[model samples]
Target: TYAETKFIEAEAEFLVANSGSFQATGANAAAYEAYLEGIRANMDKLGVSQADRDAYLSDPNVAVGTANLTMELIMKEKYKALFLNPETFNDLRRYNFDDTIFRGLELPEDHNSVLNGQWIQRAVYPSSEFSRNEDQVRQAEKAIDQPMWFYN
Candidate 1:
């Protein structure tokens, strides 16, 4: 499930990145157009049916003027691509939107939260250190709960 979600997220991010390319000059625009065409071709090869593709392409809500694509549109495509993957949670975390119900007013308080804050950057080293290097393990243990330079 996680893998599926990640795939969707990656696909969405790729589309977002691709659309952003239009902000470039003539040469860049040509290159990005080619890239988008390639993506459409590949999606077809992957068995995404013509009807679905047309649905996405024709959706009025997804239109971005001459751009024809936007982050929200791409994200909708991604959600379809992911289907039933638990990894969508990771995407949610990275986007900092796991709890849309709260609308950013609250966040989960757990080791995962470290990902959104400073502690994650200073995670404890692997417990394997205890078996092969006791002294190093002890030193690391002392620093486990402390913040790193980035946090400061």
Candidate 2:
């Protein structure tokens, strides 16, 4: 979706600035624009009324300018916009489930004990895969709580 693309653009621009390849001012400006566009695109997709969209976007909390923009805010918006998406799970893993980036996120009270109070890193392979290709599946097997290489 266009909204997802805009969110990705916002993240890329913000990360580029942090990586020192671009000036913070210019990169943040681009990121901020992309962030707002992402929200607008998602709202449009959902058929939100124009007046409601305008009111939400113009709210003080949502309209925080470039200088106040942070990776947390970008990710939070992306999380909200992509609710229940597989990409959200992938993103949570990418960020190692850091609460700072995903405000209000909390571990389930009865989460798997294998996690030892940490977030689950990834889903286990389906049982059918292990049954069909035991050798390959065993080779790739990891603890349920172990972090994947994709983590930052």
Candidate 3:
């Protein structure tokens, strides 16, 4: 979707700026503009009224200037815009689910005890795989709560 692409662009620009990379100066301005453009694109796609969109965008929290913009804000809006999308999980893992970057996200109260309070990092391989290739499956088995190698 156009909105999703803008959100990803916003994050990429933010990362370049925050990391003090070669394009830091331009990236900062680009990040903020892209962030707002993402919101606008999503709202427009949803058919939100212009007045309502203006009101939402004008709010202090949503209108945070470039100097005040943070990855948390960008990710929060992106998460809201893509709540049902699995891509959000990829972003969460990239940040190691840092509470600071994903403010207000909480583990479920009834989460599985096997995790011992840690986030569930990956789904267990299917039982069908174990049944068909027990030896091979065992060799590659990992705890369901173990973070993927890329995430680590």
Candidate 4:
């Protein structure tokens, strides 16, 4: 929870600092520091050894720099720290639903039949409900393969 909050704070600070307004963080460096702190909090929570965390952070790909900081890097680390959580799907939606941000994700070969090749957005309405409420279901057009109405 702290890690998530820190990541949000980092992103917010970075955006604010870059916007030319009064820097809420007072300096651009604070944004980068917050990002690193978020990742460190995650690493600590995940039981990564201090030595390993230091090594990983030094790997250039993971350690952030003021010049090198990008939304992609922040989202990638946020995604990693959020592994196995259902909210990750919502993050994908929020971030343009791109699989590239999640480097390891591979869509199942035998995907949901209704989805065909499109990304799944919502679960199918129950078959039992469909029979009892066919008219409502038809009007709702609760397509399993399409995004929810709000997203649309």
Question: How accurate locally, in lDDT, is each candidate?
Answer: 0.44, 0.83, 0.83, 0.71
Q: What is the C-alpha RMSD of each candidate to the true structure, in Å?
A: 8.1, 2.9, 3.5, 5.6
Candidate 1 lDDT (Cα, whole model)?
Answer: 0.44
lDDT of 3 by residue, 1-152 (tens): 88899999998888888773322323478999999989988999999999999899899988988888888888888987888999999888777788887887789999999999888888788999988999998998889777775532
Tally clashes: model 1.
Answer: 4
Can you give the lDDT of residue 148 in candidate 4? Answer: 58
Model 3 C-alpha lDDT versus the unseen true structure = 0.83
lDDT of candidate 2 over 12-96, digit per residue (tens) = 9888867832223334788889999999999999999999999999998878888777777778889888998999988788777
Q: Estimate each model's TM-score.
A: 0.37, 0.89, 0.83, 0.67
Off by over 4 Å in 1: 1-48, 65-69, 98-152
- Which sections of candidate 4 miss by over 4 Å? 13-30, 124-141, 148-152
- In TM-score terms, candidate 4 sits at 0.67
Candidate 2, residue 139: how far the Cα is off, in Å: 1.6
Cα deviation of 45 in candidate 4 (Å)?
1.7
- How many residue pairs clash in all the candidates, one count each? 4, 0, 0, 0
Number of the candidate with higher TM-score, 1 or 4:
4
